[model samples]
Target: MGAVTSSMAAKFAFFPPTPPSYTLEEDEETGKLAMSGVPRRENVDVVRIKTKRATDVVAVYIKNPSASLSVLYSHGNAADLAQLYELFSQLSIHLGVNVMGEAPMLPYIVVRQVK
Candidate 1:
């Protein structure tokens, strides 16, 4: 397989679960945003959740995926949550999954990796 190519301005890049969709960019300095001209429209149900595992804390944006939920996580100390948000969204699209996220909100979902 070949390496993936992305065109986003965020620290990280994420694609939707579906093929030929939009990208999400997370700017450690400037929150997050969905890249324009994606194949699918932005769904209101998409959610972003901040989580911490063991001594590592990160953020994951969960999209509208039915089979397996796609997750976009940032490097532990690479950048702040702001930068990760956008990239997380884009990552999901790249992986062919919907996205769910929260921008500075409560009622978050915490997930633990069991492996």
Candidate 2:
């Protein structure tokens, strides 16, 4: 029963874009990472962090020189980093705070039945 519920929930909770919204690229010379088709920003950095589950999660960090606070923005399951890149940048600039947006990992929520 729990398995069936989990399966149904999984279907509704995740909606990864087909073909993916963007691809990660690394500069051969500088070793810097960027998302394809997104304009490069000197204040923004693209990084990947390894989770305990061994999943690599992509995150975007936007820096503001006047920032006295930082925010960790976790987007909704239906959206990806590419979709919210502009918002994150704007927030960092207008709010004068650093913004870090963590991409959603569907596999991070794999449902397990308890014994």
Candidate 3:
């Protein structure tokens, strides 16, 4: 019964955006990753980290010059890193701290991990 309930829950739980909100592009000269349609910042970096689960997670790192601490922010399910880029930047500026925003993988990735 528990297994059946878990299966049903998994089937209905994830709803990643169909076309994806943004795409990652590598800068030819700098060899850095950036999100499409977002302004590139000198202090911000887009990175992909490989997890032990064999999945790659994309994260945005914002640097504040005077900041001594950092915040790891996980955005809501409804949004992706591109959608929250400005917010993360502003938060780092106002709070005077570095910010790292982690992006959620697509639904298919999550489903595959479950299996």
TM-score each candidate: 0.30, 0.74, 0.73
Candidate 3: where are CA atoms >4 Å away? 1-14, 75-78, 107-115
lDDT of 3 by residue, 39-71 (tens): 989999988777898777778999999999999
Instruction: Kindly list the per-residue Cα lDDT of model 2 for residues 33-75, writing each as its tens digit.
Output: 7876678999999887788978767889999999999999875
User: So what's the TM-score on candidate 2?
Assistant: 0.74
Clashing pairs in 2: none
lDDT scores for all predictions?
A: 0.39, 0.77, 0.77
Residue-level error in angstroms, candidate 2, position 99: 0.4
Model 3, position 38: C-alpha lDDT score:
89
Best by TM-score: 2
C-alpha RMSD by candidate, in order: 14.1, 9.6, 7.5
lDDT of 1 at 58: 31
- In candidate 3, position 67 carries an lDDT of 99
Residue 90 lDDT (model 2): 89
lDDT of 2 at 95: 90
10-114 per-residue lDDT for model 1 (tens digits): 325432122222234444444543332433344423234445632323333446555275553434323334444556556666776754433332223132222
